[model samples]
Target: MAEAAPERVYTEQEVEAYLGENLPHWKLERGWIRRTYRTHSWKSTLMVVNTVGHLAEAAWHHPDITASYAWVEVRLATHSAKGITDKDFALARKIEDVVCWQPGREGGPLEGTPAGDPRFAYIKYDKT
Candidate 1:
């Protein structure tokens, strides 16, 4: 069996540029790419954590996650590579897409959770 090639680690400048152009909400800090998601309640926070867990497991790339009563913070880096790499960015993009999805704005049949309603509120999506 052939071994996988080494992943290319991204420099800080490259990470910054990618974050600016592709993921405006994410930032590079302490040698890792990180993003924090705000939620309406603890339930929502757990949902975010579980969602991220599922995505990470499916992608076969994991991220360090921290959660509290109303927020979740995700930090991504390539542990084996000892730096941020393409895998981190790819997983981050997937996490952002799924975590921040709002079906109501997509003109699709699925109307998302009711806006301005605490009972149905989940993620506190960043305004674009």
Candidate 2:
């Protein structure tokens, strides 16, 4: 059975407390929980992006991702509610679970293989 989402409105205290206790790898910024990552190549970055897409679809909540040749910047915010909500917190947690940042780990193929260069491949991550 699917789990019901947390209530839509959370007080500022709730936001702060939840974030403080749960997301050590993410930082609250401009009403969003933000993180940045760089991959070995553009292909890896795209792979991470597609993985995030699947996650967003499954969660029915999305984040803001900026992917470039070698880096991906992710920002999660719940604009509809005007502040961070449980959904934002949930997504941030899920995202943190899937992005890796080992300094020299080659995520996989470079830009031209059949797998193609993703520039966004998602992997599990921790405080780097």
TM-score of each: 0.98, 0.66
Compared with the true structure, what per-residue lDDT tens digits does model 2 show for residues 15-118?
A: 66777788766677767777776666767788888878888889998889998887778888777667777788888788766654344455654332232334
Clashing pairs in model 1, backbone N/Cα/C closer than 3 A: none
Residue 8 C-alpha lDDT in model 2: 83
What TM-score does structure 1 among the candidates reach?
Answer: 0.98
**Per-candidate clashes, comma-separated:** 0, 21
Candidate with top lDDT is 1
Q: Taking the tens digit of each residue's C-alpha lDDT, what string does model 1 give over 1-128?
A: 99999999999999999999999999999999999999999999999999999999999999999999999999999999999999999999999999999999999999999988889989999999
Report lDDT (Cα) of residue 17, candidate 2: 74
TM-score of 2: 0.66
